[model samples]
Target chain A: MTTTAQTRAHDAANLGLLPIFMAAAAGLTLLYFTGFAQASVYHDSAHDTRHTLAFPCH
Target chain B: MTTRIFASALFAGLLAGLVAVLLQWSLMEKLILEGEEYETGAKSHFAGVLKLNEDGETAEQAAESGDGGEEEGTTRRFALAFFATFVTWVGWALLMVAGFALTERYGVRITMKDALVWGTAGFGAIHVMTGIGLPPELPGQPAAEIELRQMWWITTAATAVIGFALMGYGRKPFHFAAGIALLIAPHLIGAPRLDDYSGMAPPELSGEYVARSYAVAFISWIVLGLAAGYFWNRLQQPPA
Candidate 1:
């Protein structure tokens, strides 16, 4: 027989597909902003040497 | 293990950054700018050279004759730069995952909810900035693509803010689709191409070029995000 505490721990660990997918999704989401952070390295057409970050939307 | 996770994030970032860089440099430039112009302009395109043929002229002569344009020599440098950028991308992602998770520990939001903010920061802030920044620095500056810049930023920002907000509002089933939409909506709008050399024989083929390029861009973005996510998950179990 499974211990009640063990079962609860297992349930908490799972967090369902939404959380798992979100965790995965979040990685991608953060990439967008950090990718834009690359822009700070590039200032329009005036300067050169961009850091390779991009916001595909922009 | 914690260190390994951190390292993985770094690796992921560098790979992500490098891939993002390459996509921006090779693929993005081609679809948006090169599609309109036949020439690769001041920079280079590895693929565009395929369209060029040099039957009669010397290799150098043909290349100069505007028939052979390839980024042959700079491959090593670009490769190195790509590797470094990829590392940085992972670093950024790791920082985000860890930071957001910590905040959630305080009950700021559920872990899933926090992930949403992380996604916004990634999509909204990072990619656009990088795209706008890097190209000007490469050797042989093309004419400052000013009009294109304005057009890109305005529409891109609008789509990002509105798109992500809606995605966030809707959540769940909306997440993946929203993420994909937010990713592509800007690029699909067609970045301004001056002197584009992709050379659609009939000119109308431009749509095909745009669609093909945007499709590639979406795929790359998705890959970038997935890599970061997998790395983040591996790192999560590291003992603090």
Candidate 2:
């Protein structure tokens, strides 16, 4: 019983797919806005950063 | 568990973002600002010599007509720069943490030491691989269309990430072979480019910008890896 309980605890400690997917989605959105967004406002605001980070920019 | 993962990512991401902003301020900001002078025609690469535009006006005259638009206030510009850098690093951190968690689920052990390796891999995928085609550009550097370049950049980074992940996690020889192919495929497709390599900024300035950008990115990624690894380990521990 103790071995089974411990095994269950260990498995629970590992992360699930949902949270990982959510994090990835959020990250991609933020990266897209900061690095790749083409709006002139975004381009103007992030001009120097776009250059420094090597993002494609005018 | 989900909350804990996000909390850890937030803390680590913010910390790394702060480091990246400070590094950018010190190392790269001046060069960018200087390059902008050329970009805006506030300064000319040819010094005293005047270049006539297609309209037959001198470059200086065209600049005086306000073609480049008004410069943003210094404070506002600085704020924007800081915000962009912070957002970028946070995004990268979240991705890294997610990667760590996913890999752990797949029977890979994620120690603080391993996180550093992960961080380096992130840098390799995002910067080094993409850089081979695009390199880095200065303000006035001639380039292909933004949309085309952006698409290529996204594709390259994506392929590199998947390629690296497969190589790192895959069990079969076929997986590794596929990973290598993915890594090479983007470069084989090539990045969008222009026929001419012309730019208003001096070649020396552009060269310096590329070199410094890579150096700053490397340091930031290393710091990000260390901080994320430390936090990931710390947060995973059960309360005493």
The candidate that achieves the highest DockQ relative to the unseen native structure: 2
lDDT of 2 by residue, B131-196 (tens): 999998887788998889999999999999999888988899999999999999999989999887
Cα error of candidate 2 at position B168, Å: 1.8
**lDDT, candidate 2, A1-58, per-residue tens:** 9999987777765556888899989988988888988888888888778888898887
Candidate 1 chain A minimal-lDDT segment of 10 residues:
A45-54
Docking class of 1: incorrect
Q: Looking at model 2 chain B, which ten-residue stretch has the lowest summed lDDT?
A: B66-75
lDDT for B51 in candidate 2 is 57
lDDT for B240 (candidate 1):
30
Identify the candidate with maximal TM-score. 2
Tens-digit lDDT track for model 1 on A1-58?
5698898777555333344345435554544433333363323321111222322222
Model-by-model lDDT, in order? Answer: 0.45, 0.84
| lDDT value, residue B208 of candidate 2 | 90
Q: Which pairs of residues have clashing backbones in candidate 2?
A: none
